[model samples]
Target: MKTFYWLVKRELWEHRGGFFWAPIITGGIFLLLNIMGIITAEVLGASHGIQIGASGALTQVIAEMDSGDMSKVGILLDVAMYAAMGLLIVVLGFVVFFYCLGALYDDRRDRSILFWKSLPISDASTVLSKVVSATVLAPAIAVVVGIIVGMLQLLILAITLSFHGVNVWQLLVLAHPFKVMFNLIGYIPLYVLWALPSVGWLLLCSAWARNKPFLWAVALPVATGLLISWFGIMGLFHLPTRWFWTNIVQRSLFSVFPGTGSLFGGTPHNAPHIDGLHALDLNTTYQLLGSPDLWIGVVAGAALLAGAIWFRRWRDDS
Candidate 1:
């Protein structure tokens, strides 16, 4: 148990810089935006107050002139804000993915896997620790950073509203900030499950490939699938081609987890190459379990994991 924790800790310590800098940068940007929004709103509202008060006719004309336009402006603002947030979150996910890949790949490239294998730890523990680092620890750290940034942004917004003579406490409470937080909590688990296959493949690729694991991992399967399909179309090795087409039911290992969207299911994102592909539904899940494709991923995952262990175990340490 301690060994597992130590392994995970060591890996995190090595790569903490990448994970730690994102929230700080994102939060700073969010804070700046919130402050600017508050200042702009206050200035605009104050500038228009005298004109609005002096003539009801002028006020009505001003409202009429911009009523529809205001909504469009608001929508644009919302899109921009969400886009920024989404970009931050996406970067966080990317950092986590690449960090895990780097960690796994680095050890192999540097011949450090053998050093760990010589320890008392089992292969399962070593691999599992990296999985924990990628799936759980990384996300946990990112979310905490997000929450802190979010709270700081809210505080700045509130202060700005107060200065502008608007009470925003009810708005804040009604927004159910805590409920919003809980919803995010629910999303993290799903995200982890969604990310698992990529994480696993990253480790396996690290273990197996001597160089450029990313390129080969993607290119090899795609090349194999295409060749098989071409052969099937040509009526050469028809059965082999048919089996290859059928068994690639899911392109990503993440698809094997229950409740992944149709994007990863049965076909590669509904591309034109695979004709007669059905949208993945609950039925597709059951069908996948019964199908040869799921079994192949299962067997392949097991074999890769076993091979990673053996590679670590028997590889030259000197």
Candidate 2:
């Protein structure tokens, strides 16, 4: 347990600079864009009011928007939320990819893995540390960045709306930091679970990479899935490649939350269940989690993680 904690802490310490500066960089970019947006909107509103011979009418209209108009405000807030979420996801994915890619490679390059191997830690602990870093620690950092960015986005939105004369008290309340943080806490475990497959692939790559594993890590599975789908033989092996794509792409963490009955509006609609199976109000995630495809993903993930550990334990270092 002590060794495991050290391994985790050591990985964090190495990457702390990147993890710390990422949010600051992202927030800066987002803040700049938002400020420009506010300026553009104000100029547009002023011009619009001038065209109607009401010098300050547009400003007054912005100020006069009441709670009843919260729906409109909500739409704008959603835009900001969506953009920030997208940026956060991209950044998180890249960080995970790079971190895992570097973990074993860096150790091997510096003969640091040998030093650790000489320690009392087992192979399981070595691989498990990487897994935990990818699955838990890396994502946790990204979530924190997301929350900070989200809060800043919310503040910008509120201030922009106020400048336009919109009282965004209710909107601000909905975007409260504590509420968002708690909601994130509730969601993290599920997200980690959902992301396990990718983390497993990353671990596999980190273990196996010689030159450029990211390219292969991404392309190999995609190519395999395509070939299997094209041969129409996935059914023979019970490999539901199509279903895996849908769940990972559509239903996974960092994806949009589907509103009622919508199911992301992208997937083919299943027939409305006339049976008892669909009567319950379980979240759409029920379908994602319960799908045989996701289980297959889990099995594949387990295999990958196991293979990584096996390879690291027995493979020649030369």
Candidate 3:
């Protein structure tokens, strides 16, 4: 158990740039932009003879917020948080994607695998640590950093509102930043499941590719798709190329978490009208858990991970 902990820790130690610094740097930049926007808005208002300390749209918005309803504030805050999180997700996704692509291959290229293999760790442990780092640890770190950045932005906004005669307390009471942060955190475990197939496949390519894991990881699936399309065109077989691409490959690669709309309780194309703290719906979670595609992907991922372990164990990369 201790060895496994150390293995995971070692992955973190080596890849802290992706798992830690990327999110922090990205979040910090966004927070700075938010502050600058607030300042710019205030300056523009002043130029237009709008008193910062006078009742205006902000006051009206606050008045519309039900004094008894906290969800209104939460939803309002969610908009900003969602925007920030959206960027974070994009940046973090790339970070993890590239991290997974290089996790094993980089070691071999540098001849560090020789040293790692000489350790007491098994191949499974080594590979699984990378998987856990990519899926679980990376997301967890990003979420935590995102939450902090979000809270800071909210604080700055609240202070600005107070100076402008807006009811800062009411805004804070309505926003429920803590609850929003918790809700975001709650999505992480499900995200890991959603991302498994993609991450696992990347690991497989990382472990097995003699060179350029990135090229092999991307090219193989694309080539497979092309081959399938050609076969379908020639009437060699009945292939639902579009369906397979959309439902399987795209789902694995792009759907970081299935039923994320359920988290906000809205359709994918429409934003949810946040009326209250929409706690994660267990039914949606259960639906994902019971999904055939998810399990199929999981099985496939497991097979790929096993292959990765085998490649790591037997292939003489040195």
Candidate 4:
């Protein structure tokens, strides 16, 4: 158990730049842009009575909260928080994609796999460590960094609003930082489950490809789809080549919240009308967890992961 833990830790240590620093840097850039926008808004508002768009909306929401109805304010901030998280998720997803693509291949390319294999560890453990790092540890790190960066950004916004005579406490009341953080944390497990198939597939390619794992990871699927389309085999099978690509993309992107409508699916016409701070509902989470697609993907991912381990054990990179 301790060895497994250390293996996972080693993966994190090696890929800290991608799994850790990338999100932090991206969040820092977002924070800087937000601060600069606030400053610009203050200057413009002072000279021309023009309101900063985001702050103006927030200020209005805060004003409405004085009337004893704080729900709208909370909902607005919740949506904003989700928007920020969505951006961070996109960045994290890309990092994990490339990280998995190269996880096994890089060791062999640099002849480090020889040293790793000489250790008293099995290939399964080594591959599992990379999988856990990409799917679980990497996302966890990104989420924590994102939450911290979010809190800091909101704190700055609150202070800036207070300077303009907007009540900052009202903003905090609406923010519901604890609730937001909890929901974001809850998303981590769902994301791991949702993204497993893609991650496992990448790991398989990483272990199996003799060279250019990225090309194998990306090109093979695309080429297969293209060949099927060109040969009209897809038409005969009643499965369009586009469906193959679309399904993979949707599975990769939308598996996080299964019952909830996806960004790819377009907003549902019957979407719930939330009038208050959107706390993570246990019922909705239960429904998402019960999804058949989620289970199917998990099974597929497990098969691919098994293939990866087997390939890594037998393939001689040197």
Candidate 5:
């Protein structure tokens, strides 16, 4: 158990840039851009002699807005937070994709596997540690950072509203940031499942490819997809080419992307104004467990991951 912990820690130690700093840097840039945007708007408005603070028309809009309208405002805030998080998850996908692509290959290329092979650790432990790092730790860090960035963004929004004489406390109460945070955190486990296929595929390529693992990882699925499409067009075997592209090729390559898990099934259906805008519907999102595709992908991923471990155990040639 302790060895396993250390293995994961080692993975983190080596890949801290992808697992931690990528998302942190992304969130920082996002906040900075938003702040600059607000400042620009304020300066432009001031130059135009358009004062927003306590304007009678603006006050009238606030005064006339009912609970429903206020909830819409809250949804807007939720969307902002969701957008920020979406960016982090996008970074997570790319990070995990390349991280797994190189996890085993790098050791072989640098001849560091010789040292690790002298250790008591098994290849399975090392490979599984990378999996856990990609699916669990990376997402956890991104979510925590995203939540912090989100709360700060909300604070910025509230201040902006205050400057315009709009009371934002009610919107804050309705926004349910804590609920949203919990929702993002809760998605991590399911994300692990949804992500396994992509992770497994990448790791398998990493462990098996002697050179240019990235090229192999990318070309295999894409080439197969192209062949399937061409044959289908030529009236071969009546294969569902479109379905194959979407479900197989795409999932194998891109399922590590967050929200793509259930393909936006997490969106809150209760938000009528936005017609299914941001936020997690735990009930609906959890329903993916009932999906055969999810489990089928899981089985395939486990098999690919097993293959990765096998290759890592024996194939050390760079």
Candidate 6:
């Protein structure tokens, strides 16, 4: 267990630039842009001899807002929080994609695999450590960083509004920070389940491909998808085209993205909510977990991961 912990830490140390700094840098960029935008708005408003609350209309609007209106503001801020995190999650897809695509092959290319192979560590432990780092630790970092960035975003808004005398504390008070954190962080386990196939598939290519694992990982599934569509195989087999596209192609390629439980095909259009603004909140996730399709992907991803482990042990052209 101690060794496994260190193995995961090693992966973190090596990939911290991607898993940590990428989101922080992205947040920083957006923060800078947002600040610039606010300054521009203030400058323009000043030129017009009218600021946000100069006419007293904005202040009166907030003062007149009832509980229902305040709740609406809270919902809007929750949405802003989601938007902040959504940007980071998109970066995560690209990060984990390339990370898995090179996780094993890079070590071999640099001859570091030989050094590791000299140790007591098994290939299974090594591969599984990468898996845990990609699935759990990566998303956890995104959620935490997203929360921080989201709060800062709100702070900017509050400060901007404060300069205009519009009861800025209400803006901060209406936001549901605890709920936002819960929802963003809560999605990680479900993301792990949804991401298994893509992670496993990319890692398998990383282990098996002699070079250009990215090409192999991308081309294989896409070629298969094209072949199915070109031959009209699904029509002959009485299966919807979407079934293969979603299950076979997307599971192979895009399962790394969150909210992919929709591919599982068990949740209703009107599924219940579990205290999050996202369509794929806990309630919807619970429903998707019951789908046999999801479990089948889980099994396939595990098998692919096992193949990755096996290949890493023997395939060493690099």
State each model's CA lDDT, in order.
0.56, 0.62, 0.74, 0.74, 0.85, 0.85
> What are the models' TM-scores?
0.65, 0.74, 0.86, 0.86, 0.92, 0.94
- lDDT per residue for candidate 6 within 29-79, as digits (tens), equals 878888999999899989988767867789899889899998999988878
> Which residue pairs in candidate 6 collide?
none
**Least lDDT summed over 10 consecutive residues: which range in candidate 2?**
253-262
Q: Give me the runs in candidate 2 sitting further than 4 Å from their true place.
A: 44-68, 71-79, 164-171, 174-179, 222-287
Q: Which residue window of length 10 is worst by lDDT in model 5?
A: 265-274
Q: Tell me the deviation in Å of residue 302 in model 3.
A: 0.7
Q: Per model, state how many residue pairs clash.
A: 0, 2, 1, 0, 0, 0
The TM-score measured for candidate 4 stands at 0.86
Instruction: Give candidate 6's TM-score.
Output: 0.94
Summing lDDT over every window of 10 consecutive residues in candidate 6, give the lowest-scoring window.
272-281
Off by over 4 Å in 3: 52-71, 233-239, 255-286
State each model's C-alpha RMSD to the native. 8.1, 5.9, 3.9, 4.0, 3.0, 2.1
Candidate 4 local lDDT, residue 151: 80
lDDT, model 3, position 136:
83
Among all windows of 10 consecutive residues in model 3, the one with the lowest summed lDDT is 258-267
Order by TM-score, highest first: 6, 5, 3, 4, 2, 1
How would you encode candidate 3's per-residue C-alpha lDDT over 73-154 as one tens digit per residue? 6677767766677778888888888888899899899998888888888899899988888878888898888888887877
In angstroms, give how far residue 246 of model 4 lies from its true place: 2.5
